[model samples]
Target: MRYLFPTGKGYQRKWLGQDVLSGVVIAAVSIPISMGYAQIAGLPAVYGLYGSLLPVILFALLSTSPQFIFGVDAAPAAMIGGVLGGMGIAMGSAEAERVVPVLTFYVGVWLLLFALLRAGRVLRFVSTSVMGGFISGICCTIILMQLPKLMGGTAGTGELPELVRHLAGVQVHPLSLGLGAAALVILLAAKRLRPKFPMAIVVMGLGALATVLFDLPGHGVACLGAVEPGLPALHLPDWSAVSLTEGLGNSLPVAVVIMAETLLAESSFAMRDGYEIRDSQELLAFAAANLGAGMVGCCPVNGSVSRSSMNVQYRGKTQAVSLVAAAGMAAVLLWGSGLIRLLPVPVLTAIVISALLGAVEFDMAHRLLRADRKELAIFLAAFLGVLVLGTIYGVVIGVLLSFVDVIRRASQPSRELLGVISGQPGFYPLGRMSQAHPLEGVALYRFSGGLFFANIDRFQKDVENCVKPGIRAVIVDASGIVSVDLTSAERLVLLYRRLKEQGVRLYLTEHIGQVNDELRRFGAGELIEEGAVRRTLYAALEDCGAAEGEVKQWIPEEMRHAVPELLRQTQELEWAYGEEAQSKLDAMTGQVLQTLEETKPEQREQELEFLLERGRWQGVIDRDAILQHLEEHLAELSRLLERSEDAVLLELEQERERVTEALRRQHPEIASYLAAHREELEQRFQRKYPEAARHIHELRQRLHQLPEDETKEQR
Candidate 1:
């Protein structure tokens, strides 16, 4: 089977008997409904035979789904029929019927085009909410469309509202009505009471029997009359200018709608535990089916879920079963159409209604009852769209909702602060009951989403809300803060300085390497500081005055035992960043400039140690390179005016404070060096910020001319 249907390698040989039995059962189940669906589609009963053939075999040959069955069915075709008919290609008029096959041909061509374009994967883009709504909408339409046929109208017009109105106009065709009612009753009974009996076959046999026994046509019964027996002659569809162009215009919407419905079914079924299909291959196989339908005088065909499910349940195991079914159907079209004609139209309608009932999926509605209301609304919207407007409108609305939902979710990611438990060592959300308590004086806050511009402000506000009155240490848990934008870095820096002002400590725990790397570039590396951060909340808690051994012992016994596992992750992060991943003590000396910029005095030692560890493992971060990155980030920030003094003034104040602290750290000897080598430092600073350098040059010259002692006195 893998070779016949190789997901990665292409098709292989697999007799898998269930496939064959499935084909036979589905063929038996589908044959009657397929014919009836053809009538509902206003296509010839023989066209129904054309519609039922070959598509399933092709789908099996190319699809990833192990159990998908493709054949003629009611819902999509019914919708297509009504849509096309409304546009004037209606049945009853021989001219219109001629146009039908040609319209189908055009639709097939369009679907083939879709498959060629690889549009199958579009299924995943649709949200579950939209699909729930849209499918319900389609189901509602199917149930409504069946109403008039059950009551007693010719399956004419193929339009729901019109069919009801048309039924009101026609005197009840009693023979047709009785047979439809009987077929409906029997098929429903077979389905509910006797699951093993083939409902399609049972209803069909009874329908044929009743027609023969009652001598039905003598009364006002609508039968398919005398079906012309023989293979439909291989005739090219007249795509002459007027009809071809008109067909193209009208059929495209039908093709798109039908194909979408088929893909939706295929995707849904594929997602189930047992059987899944290759979506890309489905498109091609469906294309071939469409081309085949057009090659014969058939209306468009699609995968039939009910019949396929039945076939599998009946133990079908091979594509040959579909082939066998197609062959049987071909024989019927050749010699049995006339004999089958005596089978009352109501009987056919009953078969169709029974099959379509299975498609309604009330289970979907039950799921809605269990899900969130917003999701329920999406499902209902699709349901209502189909019921009120029709299947076509319903799916379009579904597609739109799906797109909106995806954008909404990704754009608005949730955030939370994670805190390390006092005795547990490992981190959990500070808000969650499992680990609700904050470190005694330390605030361990976890940011759950990526730090992007869209979410940065909310993140800042949440952190501020936590930093109320007497918080001593503020731990920023960056494990959840996976990705970052430069703006996010600037916002982070503002928080870092804010905590510093309250005389609180800021520790970054579990800093994702990617985000930490971005922070490093944005001058946040200096602001957030090194050594202040830990990979695990346990380690961070230990640093923040919690006794390391006691905390370790307190870890919920399950996790307390996994200390080594957690340590491995920490080691991996430290290994990735060399001198940059510095410890407080190791960060001193040659990295004195970095130490000077450290956001906290405590982590300065830890950061230097981290740097030493980094140097030991990897190597040094070039001092010039680090400075260049920081200067560039600063340059970028300077250009972004706060828009107004009040807009982000606190953030601005925080930045100003960090800069002040860094500059204030210059040693007396370094200060003396700055005065003695003012020109060299000035040139280097100018090279980094030429415009600022020009402004500072005059001040330096004025200071030098005035005498350094006078400048020192003014300071």
Candidate 2:
């Protein structure tokens, strides 16, 4: 029962009042928009009200999302209208009415099948840029379709070219044009100033009031005539009107558009509100909503982004909002249907245009332009495709381009020959790091991305190019390579044989244990049995006799005040700044010590905080590392400031304790590793600097024996 009625998942008794108010607001906002989209779908305005009542109630009951609003929206209506125009069906005719319900039924069945198969997972492959472009294109096309209505002419049909041609030939009516232009300006201003306000309903009310005050119809300003007042009867679709195959073929794109738009909107709202939604259950909700639409002889319905945004803005907490909205639509149908007749056509058109304009995704286009021009080009291609070619072709082109881009990226994975920098602990790319150089008689290569058939030849060529004279060993770093296909594994064996013939050894290192299991299964177990697979790059270098000696250490007199270069080269720092990162560390340390010495005692703490904030360089250095370094200089700071050593030690210890607690809270794994390996690290430090190790040992004993009450107060 909970699964079926997911609206009750997190329901609260106190939220009913807010939900009722939000539902009324949503109903007020959706009434005009749905009526306008109904005309776009080639249906009567009453059917739009019919769609809102049942489909929304069904979706509210079945949806996994707590706040998403469902109704007749732009994309599916535009596509259905385009399909009807292509089929030579006249708007509002009996044949058109019968065919639309049949099409809606087919769309419902498709959605049901998709939910059964869990096809929601397939949507992950569609890129965000493609979705933005496709949606923007649909909104643009629909806006053009509504322009003729605003001018006291019939709606335009087909694609952008045909719509433009139709728009070019229409003769404008001055009174209708004036009303529409004024309504559009007001709606736009209200959206900018107070987005949560129900301006669409206000505009509709004003348009109606103006019609009675000025006799709009008598003055040749077109208005929708009186609609039949009543609830919709249960009317099953007459499937005999259209052939099953043709109906399914035309409805497939409509179903896809609805699923994509609705799921994306649902996911976005869930993320924003800090909740989770079941994708398959959402698909089921869409299926139920469309089925209800078909049963009521209405056009297909979908999730409404504008109304959902309004619901969130009004603090709607659960599906009670949707239920309340359904009741409001029913009340309007039963008693207030006559009011719609006085609403001016041009005013309604302007309301729709305003809503569609808001849907255009200009922010997405701007972001893609600034961040990645290649993606921007793809966005443009999809946008242009819809305008010129139509909705289905536009979606197809965008999806195909997205797949092609993915393949292109996979076929040219990043490959680099690596070497050591003078003061760094890890290998770096020889081309980018100026101080890095290849070790004597050894070549280290790193390939980032999965190994597959498409990139095996490139991988082989990179290895061959790096094997110069005197290169006795070629070590492959497989840390970045997560998977390998059978073909790549076979090629790796061939490369191993080739390198053996040239009097050079080949070794693979730093991959997970699963790759060895895969190699053994791929009939290349000899690579493992021959001891060619190593656990680490250093181990491989040692096996090949290339790691022969260590460089001499350059130690400072006061080891506590200065960190060793090797000790500063943490794995994360090396990954962020490959070479000469030691310089950044030195500058950071110097600035910290300088600030401590020059700042006044009263403002020292505040100034140190500001200094840390100003010195942050793109997060290349971690804050915990900086705090640890400062703690190491306790004695030096005491002597420089002429303070008692015990007081300085207590202050530094308090800061260190706070930072350690924060680290444990934010990054438990790193904190756990440091705590578990503290003794091992101390032994390594003692071996590297025996004299400094002895001095540090005496200082640690004195600190550990501090008064227990003082340590408790610090905590």
Candidate 3:
């Protein structure tokens, strides 16, 4: 449906008048500028008009951005002429005319292929600094190339040094030099005073009138004489004459620069106007427009940022403005050729130079220099590449630098030692937060990027450092780790074993499902033992023996009466366990009665208010049943551990111990029973399974070492 339909689905009929007016205004503004750019591309001025006509219409109909006006922009035009000129082809030569259209056609083919491949996504890697440098370089080159014409001398070809040497040898014509000075002053004044004025059109009209009236040619003033006008004859490029290899080689940079400029304009305008641009669709638009340009005898076309800005500032609606602009160009082609031929060459040079002033963009360069040194280096490399080398090679160098930057960032991701704040639930990087408190005897380490081969060694070293003295446990906060490659996973397995051998338990906490699966595949559960994967950071902290703040048992106001009834039912259940359980319940209830009598009547009611207070209450349970359940569960887990291949057996065993303790809290009688038989069970289990019995004994000792205040608080 998107392919079948064009953009601007919300077009209104009332906007037609404004669209037409803006189109005519843009046409007036773009005509002189486009012709000037055509001169930059080493083509006859009429070719600029020809390039702007069909290409503008095609891009308007095809592009997702309604405000984007496609035509010859300074960067690609300068690039085309510079690259061809660097190959020793003179500007406006017959050979250049024959080769340029073929080169443009290849650019079109490349853009279409790029759209098909969805390669627009790669633009993300091209940093803004690199782009700024490339553009600044192009601006410098264009300004240098125009200097000879501005001084009434023939334009120089070759690199900057060669151009500079050639300029030093040329004799400046006084008449042409004076005319160029006047045109530049008028152009700058008009832009500074009134940006909305058609400065190019006004300058062109006055220059042509003055040249004819003053007989400027007789005075040594250079003029573009006898331009043949009219729409170019539509035809496909001659395949037999086209040099496929040379054409492809030259067109690659032009195609890349065009897409970069066009997409940047598309995105900038779309963002300001509150709309979304389909990048792939915009690339398709570029392909179609360049193909149209190739069909005409002209250089390639791309979105012009300056004219597009005018289109928006003038409040153009829909593609109608572009259609109207193209019609304006058509009118010029049909009747304005004679006027174009009469214009002075210096005036056109002045117009091109003035237009390119915006491209220098010093503010952006300064920002890059201040913000990041690496990005600034990329900017300079691109800039110097174009200035010292050529635009094509400059862009290539810039892109390569950008890729290196991306790899450097990925290979050295952030590693943090995390700590929790006093009352905050989430963890933070330790020293970064002033109020954050580190978990005692435990280290929470976080890796803030994908675990891949390039950085896996660094990841291992960082983890090994966490096993410092006094740190008994290490919890890897895997919340930010989105991906884990095979190499990194293997490193993790080895790191776990190393930590285990040093008596420092390692745990992975709060990761997505994929990391969990990867851990299992890497034998995290079996090789590192089952207790390694924890559902939450808090649970891992608890297992590591980190002290928590006070916890209160909550009962809602409406459910307060039900607590007494629950307590009564527990008393009856204790009798089912025979005399031992019954006797313990009898003593607990008797203590509660004695406390109630000792308290004043007023305070006794408040004490009985369970919802409003926090305390431990004795409850009844069958001790034998719970003990029997624990023994059965452990026996089954032991069998499964022996039979299973590389499973998290220790984790399962630890989970069993945790669950048994929770059961003890529920059945206080089971607490007594376990306390009485723990030593006997450990000694017996040690004879059968020494390793497993040692882990169980360690767990019991840790539980015993917990502060009595915390034990009562837990109860």
lDDT of each: 0.59, 0.76, 0.69
Question: Across residues 284-308, which tens digit of lDDT does each residue of candidate 3 receive?
Answer: 9899999999899788998776667
TM-score of 1: 0.71
lDDT of 2 by residue, 1-715 (tens): 7767787775788998879878987776567668777878889877888899999999999998988899988778878887888899998888888889889988999999989999887656667677677767877887887899899887776788989999999889999999999999998898889876777778888998999999999998888756678999988899898898989999998998788767765765675578988989999999999999999988889988667766766678888899999999898889987876787989988876786677677788899889999888888888888778876688678778778768777888888888887665677889899888988899999988888899989999988887999999899998888778899999999999999999889988777666776776787766764547765576567668785654221122243123232223212323222343344455566678887778777676667667665643312124545544454555666655566556655665565567567646534445654454445445744676577567666765776886898656533
Q: What is the TM-score of each candidate against the true structure?
A: 0.71, 0.71, 0.68
Per-candidate RMSD, Å: 12.9, 17.4, 14.9
In model 2, which regions exceed 4 Å deviation? Answer: 5-8, 11-22, 39-42, 78-90, 239-253, 264-276, 305-319, 549-715
Candidate 2: residue 566 Cα off by (Å): 19
Angstrom error at residue 84, model 3:
7.6
Per lDDT, the best of the predicted structures is: 2
Alpha-carbon deviation at 297 in model 2, angstroms: 1.2
Worst 10 residues of 1 by lDDT: 616-625
